[model samples]
Target: MLRAQDLMTENVIAVTKDTEVRELALILTENKISGVPVIDGTGKLIGVVTESDLIFQNKKVHIPTAVAILDAFFFLESPEKMEQEMKKMSGVTVGDIYAPEVISVQKDTPLDELATLMAEKNIHTLPVLDKEELVGVIGKSDIIRTIAEGR
Candidate 1:
């Protein structure tokens, strides 16, 4: 019957939108954590940035297939997807590439619900919130640690 507050790691490491990608990478490497929460100037939780965002920079762009008929051209795939990929590929800062949708849990959230949300969404770092304020974070590693330690 554990709740998020039971095991969530306090003293969260967070970054602002303007933080450079290189600095963010260094932070993750030095801390040995996969990701961190992104906060705004007001310290409001705005998003979560992870290692995947960094990796996205190196992924090969899959150009959408297109065909031409009459006097117009048709794209077999979504051009918007390609545009998004290109943007991420050239991102210089956390603001350019961070996942803006904040998938967070409150301190009192049940552990089971938190686990389920993470599994379903494939989230690695989940920010723990108290109202609109950033408080702590939970990660997949935390869940694994809890299980392995038989807590």
Candidate 2:
């Protein structure tokens, strides 16, 4: 069986959470990648930033609907909330859009298991960690390549 380390991308491109959304989007486009792992000052995996996160910045609207009305009754919707979302959509940094709850796998993990995990979680990528330090990243494309090459 192939291992995560065998197919993971070692030359991983990462960014800091404080990076601007515009810059992050550029990085993703330049690198031809959909997402990037967000690191902290100490180079620790703090979150995962993706194109979807950045795209959401262009989708903020305060038009109240039925869902908004229902949420308002529970104090879940307010002008302040809309303002905050608008701010996030406009001037928010990658830190504001990153998904802090990241999923990862060990470098030596079995590829079969990793694939299963990916399917179950509906995730397209997984960071490969060695003792909590990022060593590589594995994506569905990598898995396909591995299968095609019989690696």
lDDT of each: 0.93, 0.82
Error of 2 at 99 (Å): 0.3
Best TM-score among the predictions, by candidate number: 1
In the order shown, the candidates' Cα RMSDs to the true structure are 0.9, 3.6
TM-score of each: 0.96, 0.81
Report clash pairs, candidate 1: none
The ten-residue window of minimal lDDT in model 1 covers: 127-136
Best candidate (score: lDDT): 1
Distance from true position, residue 67, model 1, in Å? 1.5
- The C-alpha stretches of model 1 lying farther than 4 A from their native spots are none
lDDT of 2 by residue, 52-116 (tens): 77777888476543344645743445767777677667755887778889999999999889999
Q: What TM-score does candidate 1 get on C-alpha atoms?
A: 0.96
